[model samples]
Target: MAMTQTQRYGVFAALALVMAATRIHLSLFHHDIWDASWGIFFLAGFWLRGSARWAFPLLMAEAVLIDYIVITNMGISFWSHYCVSAGYWFLIPAYGSLWMGGSWLAKRQRGLTLSTLGMAVAVLLVSEAACYVISNGSFYWLSSHVPTPKSFTAWFANLGDWYLPFLQTTALYAGLGAVLHVLTVQMARTSEHHGQMQN
Candidate 1:
């Protein structure tokens, strides 16, 4: 089913809101909810691929703004926050990797099929790994947060510690997104079939 321009805009807005809410909730309110920014970026790429020129930048700005607000609320400058460092700028490419993955999957997706699912999983794994490496690697090697004399073995070990949790969280959200996508496409097809029958 083809989407109208208005519908595309609606999906874009919804993705942005979800991203903001989840990030803010995790950082400020719940403190337990995993931030959905990563998943949202992927979803945004899938659903709003053509709008990336503007939408991606807009989402990135929203993320930075949320961090600024959260850090300031804690009486700390955004720049001084432990999580914000020289390596922090690497997030653009990290998140971009997820977006590219989604966009790639979107182009190859052929509805509810095993091949589609497999491709999605494969892409997600590769993209998530790339994201983890870019974000985590930069933090470990470039950021002042880490002590000098970093060893590859230690860094590899550190990667193992957090990689699974991040991947699991991203997969969980992406799985939910897959379910929704299937339902939406199925419903649209059914509606189209019924309309054709009526005509």
Candidate 2:
């Protein structure tokens, strides 16, 4: 069955809240936790496939706003070490790849049958790999912070360093989100059925 309008709204709210809240949590404490920033975007693409046109750009802009506020409050200048080049805009394509992967997932998938679950895992792996590669690879090569050309192997090695964390974090959150979404929806269906039966 298709998601109801209300269910769609719930998902949108949950993802937006997770993105905002997770960033705050990470910013508050110094830790090696995986960054959920792009994970939110990745999931948003899959779960919010129909919402993509507005969702992607909105999330991108939201990220910029959050970064600005977070850095400013921390006494750091947004202009100083953040967004100092046109290369920063590379995030558009970097994140676009994730959105594309997710859109693909939505087109080819539905409920989590075993085969579908297998496909979902593959989608997550490939999507997050693309996410890390584009996001990190662009930063490494294009940013003024490291304005040096790297060999092909060296560039890939750098990608590897971040590949697992991005993949793992996104997979965890997206997986959990998918499961919870299914459960919540199932529970609602059951309640509705019981209500009709009681009547």
Candidate 3:
């Protein structure tokens, strides 16, 4: 469907809010639901377009806020949940890579062509790998009192166990969002056509 510019913006913004709330809820109360944080940021980059800059920053802030609330309420220290350090700030770039990948995909996603799908999958894989490495490496090297063996080898060995879950969750959410978007567009187009016919 040819969505009006305002309608498009509304849809994207609504999706972003929903994604943010879902991520926070899952992180706080239901860790078993799988995290959608990565996918949400990626979609913001792709769908928010001109607003991508502010959207990402806000999303990151929301994450920290929610984490703080969860930790305090649980009577736990945020630092105790994971080894944190100045290196933790690297999450900005880590998540940025995912956002950039999605933005790149958006440029090529005029349709659900095979080439586009292939490219999307490739971008998701690369983006997720980059995020995992940046985030994990930061903790392994910069964080104090890490439980992992003090070797790049040890970090690399356990990479898959940590990275795979993120990869799966991201792909699941992004793909689902894309499909729903397509359906929404189709429905809107159909409604417009029917209205015109009746006129």
| Candidate with maximal TM-score | 1
Tens digits of per-residue lDDT for model 3 on 59-103? 788767776777678787877765357776888899898888888
Segments in model 1 whose C-alpha atoms lie over 4 Å from true places: none
Per-candidate TM-scores read 0.96, 0.85, 0.85
Give each model's clash number.
0, 0, 0
TM-score of model number 1:
0.96
lDDT ranking from best candidate downward: 1, 3, 2
Residue-level lDDT for 193 in candidate 1: 100
RMSD of 2: 2.5
Identify the runs in model 2 with alpha carbons over 4 angstroms from their true place.
82-85, 147-149, 195-199
Candidate 3: pairs in clash? none
Candidate 2's residue-wise lDDT over 2-61, tens digit each?
Answer: 676787787777777777777766775665555577667767777788877777888888
User: What is the C-alpha lDDT profile of model 1 across 1-199, one tens digit per residue?
Assistant: 3578899889888888988888999988876788988888888788877778988899999999999998899899888888889899999999999999998888879878999899999999999899999999989988787887999999999999999999998998888888888899988899989999999
Which regions of candidate 3 fall more than 4 Å away from where they truly are? 1-9, 195-199
State the local distance difference test value for candidate 3.
0.76
Give per-residue lDDT, candidate 2, residue 133: 74
lDDT scores in order: 0.89, 0.74, 0.76
Error of 2 at 149 (Å): 5.1
Clashes of 2: 0
